[model samples]
Target: MFYSNSWTKCLICLIFIASGNAECPKPQVEGNVVLTNEALLMNDFPEGKEATFQCANGYLKEQGSERITCTSGKWSTLELTCKKKDCGAPREKPHLKYEFSEEGTLFGASARAICDKGYQLTGPSYRQCYATGWSGRPRCDVVTCDKPPEIMNGTITEKPGEEFPEYGGVIHYSCNEGYTLIGNKSIECNEDGEYNSLPPECKDVNDIPLKPTATISITTTSSSTVPPTIRDVNDIPLKPTATISITTSSTVPPTIRDVNDIPLKPTATISITTSSTVPPTIRVSGRNNCVGEHDTKSATENAAVVGIVISTVIVALIVLFILYHSYKRKGSYQMGEDPSRTKELLQFQNN
Candidate 1:
């Protein structure tokens, strides 16, 4: 029991020593401040609290606190800085338009850039701070085109066939009637400023007259007259008026009668009578000349001309065939022989 009590007392003493007021240890550095350890620890200043960093003869300090302090058994953060070695300047991007406060700043800073009106922007807008320095350079990008195609006296349904920011895009062109297309219907715009095909044109359509044929008919009238008899002088006419009045009648001649019982009629008759009648006149209807009529006339004339041509060709073929047959017949006659006489003579000769 005495040994057990002694052990318990020893344990309590150790606890008291561990909990006593020991001072925090200070950090230590030997070379460039930038290379020094970032964190620190303390042991109640058992080895005495202190921290220090020294640059090489030609180098300088950069970020972080240069010296650290210890209080309440804990050490303050160490001061860290970098000295420039004899290295050349860092790589700079030529095309990027940006502003930087320093060649190299601590991590997590930003850079800004501006693009021309026609061009667009892209890529990371800022640089990140890294152990070596700033990381990730800013970049700029050219904007895509939105301009339309310009047509000469014509129009396109779309300016550029489609939105083409990257490469070859197509467009179409068309012309109105009475004008002919002279070039390609579509063209493609290339990055090189050249269009894929040539421009188009409009031309007048050709007008040609069709074959003509003529038609004629009586369009007017003319008249003629026969002479009439004149009366004698006054004395004889007065005597006749005192004693006589005249009447006249005329009848047409009868046609020949058939043997079958048919009525016989007088050949001709004439009588004197007083009457008057206007002479019978003749009239005619003329052809029409309206627009519809004129068009129909033209069509008819064309049809007649076509028919005449076809008939003429047929007649010519017939005549040629007749002539050819006549020639062949004449040729065959020139080589003809009498087969019957030859056969009779052969039989007689053989007998």
Candidate 2:
């Protein structure tokens, strides 16, 4: 029983000693201070027990006691003085916006960067303010582009072709007749001063199918005629003859249906009136100056003919007037000479 009692008393003493019953230890250095992240929850500390201390972010210890001892169950007042740690303001970036986690730009503070709309970020999005400087230096810039370049033998399929090609603008290309596209058909203007793809080329067409031709030889010595056979480019004779009608002068090959991105044959039709006949008209010598299919008159020639007819009418009127005047004068003279001669004549006849 006595041994059990003694053992219990020894266990109680160990617990009490572990509960800060000893005197606080002296400071390691008189005035030097060291920063710590540990927390202090107890109001009183036993002798030989120390409490750690540290300077807040953006500040450094100029001088002071890092740890204090609980001498007589009481700690000495803090002698440490914290000085500000200054890092220059975050690197200036034009057109860039920033959001800081803390109000102060002191050490250990962090900031986030965001570029303006239509602009792209070049570096890290978040940066921390260090004692030396900012963690990442970010910048903002405007990406611009001039009018889209012209492509040879090809046209831009974009509607209302824009004069200025801005970032992310897309342009589609297509080759002209008798040419084939050789590269990317669509390209986009990128952030950098460049395009997503090299402009396509319009290569000359070379693989078109060749039409068939037949040769006939007429020999006087041969007694029988030999029929010529029609064949295709592959030298294969086609059977079951088919006939098709066309009016246009164009001879472009028909494109395959849904194959090779080819185009279809033109479906245009032209109608001619059967009863129309050629009209009589004077032809201009220098050029085919006929303005319309129905207009038969030439303004220049019509004016000249009108002037000649008017001149003829005027000359005929003048000639008729002069003839009437001469005939009247002759009749008047005959009237004046008559009477005296009449009497003498009558007398001579009677005798």
Candidate 3:
């Protein structure tokens, strides 16, 4: 009974002491369990230590802490969170209208910008997939290639088609009918992306006159009016006329008596010629003078004797010429009615 009573006294004293001493307990939350709709959560964080948060899906996290607690046994009621938002960077905007490769998730994907129909892109078309999207905005620029017109011989007033950039494509050339091309017929894009080279030229060849033949010519003689006579072998002259005669011998009667006077009778036929009754003998000349001329008549007896003598002499000369020519040729002398022989004899006699 004494032990039991002492134990009861001690238990009452212990209860009073426990009841008087206040108690501090371990933290109620355990492990890393995230609270609802919170980017970051930390308990009993030191004064200088900090925490960061990030959102999932199409949302982006902000800097700084989402929530914090102290060891003073008091929890923070800041309720701040990393809100999902779009924070564009350098190329995030575009000067010209742009389109992304992906719509909501394009923040990390490449984006391309294109100018409108009449516009062109001034900067790079491709943009990098970045954490803060693209950097600078893309710009659209106007392009014009006002190339000069190409002509072979005519004027190059303006360029053909529309106006494009300086470095354009090829241009064609042509020439007029009488003209011909002497330069490049086509030009193309160059190093500066432009066309160059001089324009084409047109030229003509001079006409040549025909030459004349060498045989065609005119010559002036000593007398301008004296004509030339051109003839063949068919023309000759006519023959000439000549005169000739014959000779004879006969006895003449006694001179005619006057009408009233009596005529003397002829002497008795020269009866007295027989005076010397001896027989008469004639001698022939050695040469045949009969073939030539030996007899003669008194110039007073025959008035026509002169002409007859001349004709006889001419005949004798012709006969002698014939004899000489015949003796030289066939050794025989003869006469005929040929006038050429007579003319030849006459020419010889005259010579």
Predicted structure 1, TM vs. truth: 0.26
Between prediction 1 and prediction 2, which has the larger lDDT?
A: 2
Q: Estimate each model's TM-score.
A: 0.26, 0.29, 0.28
What is the lDDT for 347 in model 3? 75
Give the higher-TM-score candidate: 1 or 2. 2
Sorting all predicted structures by TM-score, with the top scorer first, yields 2, 3, 1
- Residue 215's C-alpha lDDT in candidate 3? 28
Candidate 2: list runs displaced more than 4 Å: 1-23, 26-58, 61-74, 81-88, 102-104, 141-149, 153-351
- Candidate 3 residues 93-158, lDDT tens each? 333655656643345555667765445677688665544545555686544434555464554433
Error of 2 at 175 (Å): 14
Backbone clashes for every candidate come to 24, 5, 11
- Cα lDDT listed for each candidate: 0.50, 0.61, 0.45
Please write out the lDDT profile of model 2 over residues 269-314, one tens digit for every residue: 3332222222222333222433432232344467689899999999
Task: Rank the models by lDDT, top first.
Answer: 2, 1, 3
Report the Cα lDDT for residue 302, model 3: 55
